[model samples]
Target: MAQPPPATMRAIAIRDGGWRFEEVPVPVPGPDQVLVRTHAAALNRADLLVLDGSYTVNPALAAREQPIAGMDGMGEVAAVGKRVPTTSVGDRVMYMATSAFADFIAIDHRLLMPVPLTLSAVQAAATPSAAITEYDALIVQGGLREGQHVLVLGAATGVGVLATQIAHYAGAATVIGSSTDPVKRTRLDRYGVHVAIDTRRPDWAATVLDATGGHGADLVIDHLGGNALVQALSATAVGGTIVHLGHLAGRHAEIDLDQLGRRRVRLIGSTFRTRTREELFAIAAETASALRPALTEGAIAPAVDRVFPFSQAEYAAAYLTSGQAFGKVVLDFA
Candidate 1:
């Protein structure tokens, strides 16, 4: 109802090329922006590299040369500019933020979307980045169609879950996923992941073939690079797609061109970092329609494996690398 105090707020900042938590001025919104008071922020694999001096995707700031690390977050609208017609104070919002580890963020009005009433703050925060990354690859790039089969690598991670759902939503006949853990495997069915095989087992590929009756999946989503590419190549139907989204397994990819050309396969790569806010908003709007029912009726909940207070941001970063969690790991600033 009233303006927040003028004093600075506690934020997780990276300065002197090191990760930190410090008191920084809460950002003020420009004419085309909104100010969000964050309730929760999720850790992304990208967030970990930025703190280690290995990430390079942050928007180049005039005052700061070093990249500020953050990609996904959830918060409430604390303030909005006069020109922003769609949002007002106290509206629970979720969107991409710059250096989202902070308690407050100033972002383009277009990037913020109203959180679905059924989704909690943590669940809302988990959806934007991961959902869009999968959307960009399978729907936009892979040309996934109804009746086609889809295979998603890194099936226990966030994007994998979204891909599995999107494939089913698109009317795929069957959707398969690869996960090493039995616990995580059980969660896939709700998302339309029809058959989830443990990649740790030597027969994972055989299981996919058996499930498809040797016709093979029409599309394969590879968020885990390296040998997963070879595995995708093997499981693909003669002219299928393999959408490359990450290097979770490792960046280096080894493949045989002769084998790939024989199948008329297509390979595409995606990074949501390069896409514009308008682009992201369009996809979110579509997903929002699909997400509303499931989000409200408990068909889906934000798969948050853990949450850490803002003070333990580094532990949150480490948790992502540990690969022990099934869902997202978040930092609670409120």
Candidate 2:
């Protein structure tokens, strides 16, 4: 028999403008939720925004007295609600959820994904958010087709690495990835990037155009917004789609309206922040169905740049902010 969960658990939270551990009550599973005992949690750039009170997905969270940190995690299911039918108590699962940087998290069961047998806990922890985001950006929103040209901006990022691999795995004819750092551009080759460009150069878009025989990219996955958004327009094919997944550069941008109109480009904005539970559930289901095989076969995997003990989360955040990490940063609870 599985041991019962303790009444309280330690969670990472922002206090006095810094991350620290606090003891909080362990959440009980609601009728449709599952209680997971987390082994590891992954960090995202948004976590930094949340820490500094610069971002909040929901308005309610901004008003909270103490908001726990973290977005996704990997763990063993410790308990399930009566309404959760497919998941059992011992299932190893990875999921996207609020307050994930804790010993326990109660999440909607539908959001849980089975941890692939090939992945360790740290790798599993790095998978959910990046995988789902790239899957949705490339396959769903961007409408990528076989043999089409795909471009990923900030290609060495956690989701960026996955985007390049996914575009290649999905049979893109040529996969182009961009990074401002020359070193990271070289590393992108291992993640199925066929063409690596340094976006810092003035002619980067022209280089993309040259690579595509002046036709531009069929689908563009953009993580850097602001000025990059304008450049992406120059690099995109007529009637192509650009899925704006993040704005690590800057949220606001001024672009040439004439170029967008002339090309008939489709600019889509995607985020989990404001999505309803039903929408998130559907995305999770589609991503799992489409990408699980690739994961099982080891064709695509999350790039974990570093792992820090949960107590060193502050340092982890520092490392990520320093722009030295090429992929995901994870926190190991054990």
Candidate 3:
């Protein structure tokens, strides 16, 4: 490959106590790694948590994980390393990295997956991280089975939409979703959501219970923590499993163990970035294969509500805070 251009690339950085845009040295793939020329990197609520130092992160991992503040992106291989024949220069690929909000990022070759020739860069960028979490929480952790009724809270968020879609594909009998905004309710059908209710409404929980004929949901995916968990618990039936995937609602939650005890409820916490290499790759491969058809058919694609040029990353993060987006807010490198 031709020599890389004069070393620097634009990146978003968190240092001291603020977000800054700076020209940092371009990342070069280490042995067992591949370099991605970022086309777009998506943002999540967790970025704010990392920025405010409010999220749980292994300090040791941060040294490997911080600096760049996002976890998903799409890019082409600019270079490759020894022992990494899984990819090559000019090959289009998608992968999640700790600090992905940059023009380029170096990731282990094993972490990279070939992008389908039919998919756009933005679509390829959308699959990693969030989508994988939903796969793990619902497919692996919750042990979802065909014909099960699944309830997805925060259904319009990045993970919620993906989870709902996955559930639909997995043969879920009834799929119900919630959004704080009534406007979001109208679009749930796109993700195959059977029932979409405004969570802010007084009787929304009752609606969910009724939707399932009082037997309650067989699986519940909770993105909003705190009270949402409690509400989900109420909507969950005996022998049900509730997977806690995110805390966009609030940090602390109150659980009535009495209800849990009587019902045999299982609450699981899932984070994609923290899992071992083998575990993540396995989930990614399965979800990728299963969802590929939906993606090709346009039934499942990353919903990009807003696209900000890569330079305007902080503004993008602020936009997420306003909760104006029902889907992902992506940082465009082009």
The lDDT values for all models are 0.76, 0.89, 0.79
Off by over 4 Å in 2: 58-66
* Candidate 1 residue lDDT tens string, 1-334: 6568456877766776567777888777888778888888888877777656665563521112223456778888888888887888888887765667777788777776668787888888887777667766777788888898899888778767777877777788989988878888998787788999876676777788889989788899987888777777878888988888887777887888988999888888776556665666677676666556655676555567898887888888888889988768888876
TM-score of each: 0.91, 0.96, 0.93
Query: Under the 3 Å rule for N, CA and C atoms, how many clashes does model 3 have?
Result: 1
Model 3 stretches with alpha carbons more than 4 Å out: 1-5, 57-66
Residue 205 in candidate 3 has what lDDT? 75
Best by lDDT: 2
Task: Write model 3 residue lDDT over 1-334, tens digit each, in one string.
Answer: 6446448888788887567888888876678777778888888777788777776543322314547677788887788888786677889877766778777788877666667777787767767766677877888899999989999999998778888988998889999999988888888889879999776676777888899999899999998887878878778988999988777778798888898888899888877546666765576677677666777777666767888888888898889999889788888898
Better of 2 and 3 by lDDT: 2
Of the candidates shown, which would achieve the greatest TM-score relative to the real structure?
2
- Tell me the deviation in Å of residue 65 in model 3: 6.9
- Superposed on all Cα atoms, the candidates' RMSDs to the truth, in angstroms, are 2.6, 2.0, 2.1
**Residue-level error in angstroms, candidate 1, position 81:** 1.5
**How far in Å is the alpha carbon of 180 misplaced in model 1?**
2.1
Q: Tell me which residue pairs clash in candidate 1.
A: none
Q: lDDT per residue, candidate 2, 25-139, as tens digits?
A: 8888888888999999999998898767777754321212347788879999999999998999989999877688889988888888899899999999999999999998898
Displacement of residue 115 (Cα, Å) in model 2 is 0.9
